[model samples]
Target chain A: MRRVAIVQGEYHVVYQPGVVISTLLGSCVAACLQDPVARVGGMNHFLLGEPGADVPVNPADMQRYGVHAMELLINDLMKRGAQRSRLRGHLYGGANIVAGLGGIGTKNGQFARNFMRTEGIALDHCDLGGTQARKVEFMPYEGRVRATLVQDQPLPPVERPRPAPVAQPTGELELF
Target chain B: MPAASAIKVMVVDDQTSMRAMIRRALQDLGFKDIRDKAGPVEALAAIKADRVHLIISDYNMPDMDGLQFLEAVRQDPVIGKTVFIMLTGSADKEIVQKAAALGVNNYVVKPFAPAALKEKIERVFGELV
Candidate 1:
């Protein structure tokens, strides 16, 4: 099977069978969308929802935003013969991973959900926010998805002191 | 503006590579006192223990996101006026607005070059010498 790995701000569409799209996500969201009847599908990874009013965004980096990423993925899929009305989505990623960091993952997940709803796309499965990072694999042509949690490093074991040996009564009291 | 060598700056991010990248950028800009922490909680504590002139932080972090960290800094009397610059992967409107509302001095999107980082700092502290 052919495998394609996409990082933040990237999307891939496939109409051929045996093609898998994958990504590792942390505080980012990936949307796997497919049109079963048309046998076409694709995936997109976005870092955030949209650029703020005062924030200056370079044109080259626009696709990193959710708004543009979504549009581009959907449009690309449609261009490959996928129908917008028959679209189905499976959302993944958006894990916080760190305890104190703000909920960027949560916000990303929310944006994906809202976008799907507002665009009238049917969401069949979703595995969003949590404290663990995720690795998502999508079979675009088959419209099949598998999401697994990426394990964090385990804590080191604590060292315990060995018990002191009991002394026999030798009666040898040396004066200091 | 204080000399880059004299001004103490703190770079906070959960990723080690990101912290190193920012540290290297700051070093390239002739910044001497650059300290980094992996998360906002420790960064906040370090600021309270010893004041820094400026803070360059990533928006997505564990144990307190960048906005929360900014709010904590803004609410504190000692470090309330510190110049802050946010580093984010995306220029998401909500994150930007929130950071601005929390009194961020400026922000630089991720995948930025050293020159861009320097420009953002210059915007906050005037020309760096």
Candidate 2:
């Protein structure tokens, strides 16, 4: 029953039986991939789909991008004896969590779905796109996942009262 | 233009490992004056006490996130114009737009290599010789 928690821009692969990988998500995405035949699996958490062409990036930060995160996870799983053809994928997170933050969650979910489809990986389960944050736990060896909604929504910022306006002197004041 | 060795840089993050990593990268880039703070509050105080040329901060932190810190920096007249760079885990457009609105000079994604860090700084201060 060893537990491993990964934050944003990280991934974990496990072949042992008693290991569980976990992460919390808000406007982010996590992908769980496994091969039933090889009994190998892994999970990755990413912040966005792809960097804009203007962004200067390198290999060290690849995991923070969904396109690269998926590739890294699959490569790691294959290295551990998993077959790409036999890989089954489960997707989670991508919750909006907060309003006015844009639809980054929707974009992330779309990216994950498109990636699996383009890669020809079979999608076993998906839980994505809501206003609440989620806690996702994956049993990599078992190829099983559980997602729980942690909060309804983040509380709105408290409104503060504005100060009364100072009265301006009308016209020109006479020298006293 | 000040040389990299002359420019003072501050690295802020809750994780010591992340701060250390950023510091190492800055050092590798030839920066001599480097300071680090574990949270935004301490970082803000330090900046007011003695200003730095650049501030590189992580987006997610315990007391106050990077956005709030950016707002605070922008609101202060004395240090508002200092160069600011945000380190984020995501490249979400919303974050980019927000940071830009807050007057962030530049931003780098997490787990960046030294080369990328150099590029970001160079973009802000021009080529570091």
Candidate number achieving the greatest DockQ relative to the actual structure:
2
For candidate 2, give the docking quality class from DockQ: incorrect
Model 1 per-residue lDDT tens digits across residues A30-149: 999999999999999888776543354554565677776876687678769887789999999887876675787898899889888877789999999998878889999888999988
Local accuracy by lDDT, each model:
0.79, 0.79
Please give the distance, in angstroms, between residue A15's alpha carbon in candidate 2 and its true position after superposition.
Answer: 0.4
Cα lDDT tens digits, model 1, B53-97, are: 999998866468899999999999999999999876543557777
iRMS values for every prediction = 23.0, 17.4
Report the number of clashing residue pairs per model: 13, 0
Model 2 steric clash pairs: none
